[model samples]
Target: MCRHVVPASASRKALLLQALLLISAGMVGTWCVQAITIETVNKASEVMCVRYWIPNEVGGGCNEVRMGNKWDIQVTDRWKAATVWATEGGCGGAHCNTGPPTGVTQFEITVDGGWSNDYYDISALAGFNLGLTVAPTNPTCASQICTSLSTCQGVVPGGPDRTKACKYGSASYVLTFIK
Candidate 1:
């Protein structure tokens, strides 16, 4: 019988090369970076709403509206701040939608981590009078701001505010993750 043995170093190199090839081919999906989840909380008395342009899974854009209270927004671009338009309004009693853009709040940009984690800057931007605290540590955030949209604080309004809630505020937070 013929004897055959692969050197330890050679075996390691081959494995490393294989791993690199897989990664380059986009086959490896463990530690890839993709999007950031922007979570928000509206502390003001007026209900908050948001309108953003997120690339949908299909191809086009996901033009969505996230009502105030608490929302989790999934975004891809880490540099460009999400174009969010907010307003103050709600359903009086019956099904009501559409809230005028009276309280439009711009957002600041903050980035953390590299190819794994994601952080954002929400200190300030423009046209936003409401206090927006990015990555808040106050306990009020958890209690006041719905941890997830499922149990979010406010209800979806009828008219223009009919979209889902993904707006950030003084109590807004950035929930980082790796894709």
Candidate 2:
């Protein structure tokens, strides 16, 4: 009878240890989740390279999986805007360099995605951004795409600010990036 009692006592002790271990794990997981929220904030900034697929012509919108070149640009009017912004994930996600920074002509916020997402307009969007501009997705001259692309295709993933230019066209695709 004494041996039986000793075994049962040990089992209860083991069970208590296991319970404590599980509770500690749950607490650590909770802390980690909270940390992520804060981390993402620190990670996000205004100036970043925005990846885009600009059509070669205005009449035609570009949508190939090609990576576009990125530039350094600003996104602030003052105050919150004054802080430098930085980001990666550009050029079809290949040229993701947030090291120095990047630039663009202008920016806009489009609600087409039902999320009021910000997008930058490209000069090429004029043809597509207009009330009506229709054409196939290819340029007349495949080699000389951007040159002869006058009104051929108007695309926007960036702008020079409202004062510099107002490119008001509903963008079909634009990826807003932040560091």
> What TM-score quantifies how close candidate 2 is to the native fold?
0.17
lDDT of each: 0.37, 0.25
Residue 54 C-alpha lDDT in model 1: 23
Reference-based TM-score of each model? 0.40, 0.17
Which candidate number has the best lDDT?
1
lDDT of 1 at 37: 54
Candidate 2 has its poorest 10 consecutive residues by lDDT at 31-40
Model 2 misplaced stretches (Cα beyond 4 Å): 1-95, 98-119, 124-149, 152-179
